[model samples]
Target: MLKLNYLFHNENLAEMIVKNWSYDPESTEMFRYYRISSNAIYPFRKDGRTQLLRFAPVQEKNKSNIEAELAFIKYLRENEYGVLVAVKSNRGEELAEIRTPWGVYYASAFVRVPGSAINQTDLADEIIFSHGHALGELHRLSSKYEPEPGAPRRWSYIDVLDWIDDQIKEYANAAIARSEVQLLREHFADLPVHTRNYGLIHYDFEYDNVFYDHEAKRCYAIDFDDAMYHWYAMDIEQALDSLQDCISEELYNHKKHCFLEGYRTAFDLPEDPDAVFPALRRFANLYSYARLLRSVAEKWDHEPEWMQHLRTKFEQSMRSKSTLFGTKLS
Candidate 1:
């Protein structure tokens, strides 16, 4: 019943969905939709407010996962975290289900955060410190979070490892990838997980996902689509990994101090944070490779030249063990 070829390219269907949210299709400017994983992202504006529209195929995200994501966003908003808030549809539904001839898709809208994404050139100590503090606050809050019974839980590290196992089974370098997975599992098994150190975290808490308002001195987080349950230390390491290109040895030491200083103000951190870096970096790289594999496997037959180039680059990175985190691999 569904037309696979026209699924993502259905502009008329997209416009209809947008209109369901009480926005005029004629007045609203729908930005081009691009693929992020299996989802399609469409950013648009109406009535002086910028909004983001997201669509995920049923195969990508189930109804429970979508509801859980929205619930988490509501929780963050209730706690006063500067996260993009989900918008309700005309029927007071936070999520919209669209059944098209091409298949079913889940749709959600969010009010765009004010300000631009933080860039490498503007990586000041204060901004970095504040970024750490924001994450610390989120962790602190997550430590006490208890979802209602039967609510969807985010993917665990084990779940990701299992996914990697399935993805790399036929990869050219399956043996090496399997070894990395085993090592990561061993490392994670040794890491302590307690109330203070383990919780749901914004797995993609990178500069691009954070919008900095200079006037307000605030960093608003967006894109919680990748939030997951993990060690708080992993979140910290992920944040630093995102800044590797912007930091030199001397600058890293200073920024690390400042960042940790701000973080400590909100929640307690481990004394030897750097000791955990090597393992976490490996974990990050493995996940990155898995993601690249997923993308390539899903679209290889119809992939654009640029996507093919990206796959090549990712394969090189995996082989060299060189990633955004740093040159050294553990």
Candidate 2:
């Protein structure tokens, strides 16, 4: 989450950032302020289509990092992959760096993904298959992707583990957390890496970030914010885990089968995909735990009732996850 004070203090910041883009000034008032999480989002209308303006503080993201993300999107699009198309700014730049009183921010725009998020209650077998196929397609493209010389690249899974190690010191149980992260580092290092089994993957390939197009019977992915280089099976594991929240045990297995069946149609599954699930789950849990702790540490001035409630909820979640971090993570 961004600092609430910074966001509120700079009342005109969003407007200033919007000007860098090629959006209509008249529609500025109609631009709706979306939620702030990893990034601040604004949804606006243009030429009868909705578009999104996303900006993140320089401390959390830089121009190079944003460019690396866009490069991957461009590659996917060129390969006929169904991904969101990035819109260029007024100066024909994919990224705009704006200097504000609070801090520097990198802003970018994209055509809003068509269709809506998959409703967990209404998840269908075909949708599950489409979701799997989408991820497989992304992986297939990711395997052959290579950044041009001197271009920035997305961080690898090891980089994220190192980030977790650095972030652990700020937690209340830093020592214990450090040990768990160390164990994860060792475990990940031992995992075999072959071009066929590992590469960049859409780390957040679950239902929320994937928009389902009922008319085309296809799924389009969004939010590559968390994309990183890792075992392809980790993406499969994470997607399956998301179903646990909404469906029953029986249905979960059935859905899993359908998903894999669809996945195999696009890309071959590793010899033993399930073998990597445990470590991947631990990685996912710890990564989220560190992020949640950081969110709780930020201070808010006259925090809204809802924000306060969210903070308390995050704290409770952290407490529950804390126990699972040390010995269990090992």
Q: What TM-score would each prediction reach against the true structure? A: 0.86, 0.93
- TM for candidate 1 is 0.86
Q: What is the lDDT of residue 90 in candidate 1?
A: 84
10 residues in a row with least lDDT, candidate 1: 1-10
Give the total clashing residue pairs for model 1.
2
> Which lDDT tens digits does candidate 1 get at residues 158-264?
87888778877886656767777877777689888888988888888888888777888877888877777788888899888777756787788788778788788
| Regions of candidate 1 where Cα sits further than 4 Å from its true position | 1-13, 27-30, 33-38, 170-172, 247-250, 298-304, 320-330
lDDT of each: 0.74, 0.80
Model 2 C-alpha lDDT per residue in residues 191-274, reported as the tens digit of each score: 889877999888888878888888888888898888889999989988888867657887988988988988988998987877
Worst 10 residues of 2 by lDDT: 2-11
Identify the runs in model 2 with alpha carbons over 4 angstroms from their true place.
1-11, 300-302, 328-330
